[model samples]
Target: MSRERLNVQAPVHELIAARWSPRAFDARPVETEKLASCLEAARWAPSCYNDQPWRFLVADRHQEGEAWQRLFDCLSPGNQTWARRAPVLILACAATRFGHNGQPNRWAQYDTGQAMMSLVLQAIALGLAAHQMGGFDAGRVRQAFAIPDEYDLMSVAALGYPGDPAVLDEETRQRELASHQRKPLEEIAFAGRRGLGFMVPDSLGWKAKVGQSACPGTIRISIRTWLKPWSGLGSRAGGCSTWAPAPAPRRCPWPGGAFRWWPPMSLRPRWIGPGGWRSGKGWR
Candidate 1:
């Protein structure tokens, strides 16, 4: 897993850093209890109005040989070229409508994605490898499993222990060895408008578990021309407006320190100001 870990720009949990999809799976079959734990983690994922719309159909190579082959048959040719080595296969599905209201729940697929995330993280926590893929025949799966039409297929994940990359083809071996990359934080999140990059200072980071230099904040988007600039609090950096924090000798999270940035519970942030600011500790 160390090879999978990349030097992330910001601090993230070891579980997240270590988690990566590997096409190479060991010959050893995944443990049943571990699979159950992964499902339990997914079961607790948050959903729209707690609808819990996700369902998982699991197939084990050692136990459910016939069922596993049915799933394997649905995979795209390229995916099957490698996925055949995995010991466990799972299909994630989401309800098309809310069970109670019978209305279209557009966020069902999103919530199912959250559940998959939880399951994958739990898999990594338990020293297993989990890889999700979208290359599969949805119609075939519905036909094979006799799935109800009310449910929409989300994705499929392969689960097992890490294996030797030597077995893979040249191109796949290169890809498996290559470092995985994610888009910069600025690219995905915007300050106010679409394509506007939201920036975060390097000093600001989250806790590994809890209470370890974590500085979480909520940011507000507004045009700078309409608001008064808080003196010595923050500057118009990257075209984002800055605000002042009241009360003397308080911690100014962004008082023109290493980088000018801030986020808080409300628009009127009471955490950043002109005085008593520490380098990393925020308020002195």
Candidate 2:
């Protein structure tokens, strides 16, 4: 018999790197406090005009009234089987109008995306997993929850621990149950134009351009680039404002001594010498 090459493996940094959308969930119920924490994390995301326009309708199987069933009814019958095991089912919604400003906000969808990311990361940190579902009928969800016309249903999320994938129905378990892959970073991030390779200054911190939107071509770089050494740690771009850190280290000489090593973990690309960062706005 031939032995399997167990030694051939993807790095853990890459293994934990991928996100899973599990249809099968353990029956273990999540605590309300934990769920609240997840939502609170979402609440802090940065939105265009600082207009946080996301709301969550959370349902748990343990609820006494008909609310649980109501929420479940919102999901397609196909989703009912697997999702029923998810202790918590959350409906993500975004307001169509931007706050009391009354005009339509171009970034509301982007902002909601930022919020959902926050919630997902928080769940991961809490040792919980969440699967964001786009399969549900949005119109049915709106009607079942009595969600108002002002809001648009974004997604349905199933949250809990992982269960045996084997238990899933043959069709679902085989079709989309496997781990998925992310597009290469090169395909995602770009320079001045779609093909241009650009670098971000270490001082400006890390910023991830969101979605499949093309690069903005010529984003205006923030003018005040005095190279504060640790300044980059403070300001991150994208809808990820919540990820920004508070008051960076005091303006000391740049760290890593003479080498000035750029951490590979920094998502932001590197630039030329001092004051070499580029910026613009149009992609998306």
Candidate 3:
């Protein structure tokens, strides 16, 4: 476990574990092609009615053209302190209404967020680190960018190659070094009811139970049969796989001291990892 990777509870695609926002960015200029590929990834993100409501105003520090300074100026002082070092800045915005119908699209922001997630993940795959900031002045952004009243401000992102943590201020450095936190699966995922815990096998202490049980051969056979179909999932390029092999099968203690199988993987999962991240290195 390198310091850069997140300490995830369960197995995850190496890319997701690798993604993180860093305040200390190397001042090197990002290539235009890399930026274009990132937006291209965002362009394909799924949206309600395929509205593709997300839009971006990009500022390359090397270029410094087209509202680049205006975008930087809108950032709050606290953010500006660190974002100044970033080689690229992006203004994320949302079209508030449907392009086809002119009626209000209630999911505009939500859809735009999906696009941003795609964009950010793409950035990570390219060996770039992106940190989105809510500290910018939205009103200032609207005026400075000459954005229409129909558009809504989403966020500002600072992007560049990762740099030394030592470059950050003491407090910021500490925050960057701290392990990323996520709520336990039970707290977020529910079964039949909203509050009911959906126990993931990793959190269920099932593996330890399986190890203690006398029937090791049965457990191996059952798990192997369950995961056989997905043994090589996400390993090939340009394939149609839904998930990247998560929440594998586990043995669980059933009622009256009997053991049972609960492979929530049957429900499947999200994410087709970007092809580049599947093979790219340099995230360290």
Candidate 4:
């Protein structure tokens, strides 16, 4: 099967770039060893204080009788529309309290997210597609599985081989073919201070272009560049502002080095008018 590849500005590992979620799953059952390996990957994920608070409840469609149907029933109707064909379903949960001291583990949910990513990446390595879904009846899951009150049921995942996108409805089929995109670096990253735009530096040997649309007072700046985060920005630093122009540079309290700026093509700033925010061009 042809896998959809990511359009990354900077180089990344092949496994990270190839990973994606698919709505259509073939009915073939995942091998027991492969499933175990996926779970094993999740088991090894690092967690806060090594709490290992993540848990999983799995159901395979090949299982006898209502075992699979019970899981299927927990899915929302929209998810059920495509997820019914998936061969395996899993519910991810996290323990809310620490085992030793019984204190609240604030990082439980975040740790569970890391574990789930490990599982998904393992599945991708095994040539299986794992799609995590938030659209499920959590109450139904708790009731069906006899989950303890201390556990938070976070999400459901569908796992199996990739299926033909033609099996999906027309609207979903189009979405399956759509390219993945991310917001430009300038929109999220900053240089000296908060609300200041960091232009890509030419010394990095990369090109950058800014697209803009204008209104009466506000302008939206869309930066297209191959820039990555250098060091940590200040905690209070804001993202691209919709209301104002780039603020003057100040002595950044952050000990990290300054951002190298490079000049490239034209960048148009979008304007925000009284009617409403006007549509503007952005990185694709």
Winner by lDDT:
1
Tell me the lDDT of model 1 at 150: 88
- Candidate 2 clash figure, as a count: 11
Worst 10 residues of 2 by lDDT: 1-10
Model 1 TM-score on a 0 to 1 scale: 0.70
After superposition, the stretches of candidate 1 with alpha carbons farther than 4 Å from their true spots are 1-7, 202-284
lDDT for each residue of candidate 3 in 31-147, tens digit (9 for 90 to 100): 999999889989999999899889999998788755677789899999998898988999889999999999999999999999988988898778787999999999989988799
Which regions of candidate 3 deviate over 4 angstroms?
1-7, 202-284
TM-score preference between candidates 2 and 4, better one: 4
Cα lDDT tens digits, model 4, 1-284, are: 11222223333343564466788788778998999999999999999999999999888888633767898898999899899998999889999998888999999999999999999989877878788999988898899889999999999999998777779998776676555556765767789886786664322223222223232111223223333335663222112221111111232211221222212212322222222223322222
Q: CA lDDT of each candidate?
A: 0.67, 0.57, 0.63, 0.65
lDDT for model 3: 0.63
TM-score of 3: 0.70
TM-score on alpha carbons, each prediction: 0.70, 0.62, 0.70, 0.68
Candidate rank order under TM-score: 3, 1, 4, 2
Query: What tens-digit string does per-residue lDDT give for candidate 1 at 228-247?
Result: 23566553222222221111
Model 3, C-alpha of 71: deviation from truth (Å): 0.8
On the 0 to 100 scale, the lDDT of residue 8 in model 4 is: 33
Off by over 4 Å in 2: 1-18, 175-177, 197-284
Clashes of each: 2, 11, 0, 15
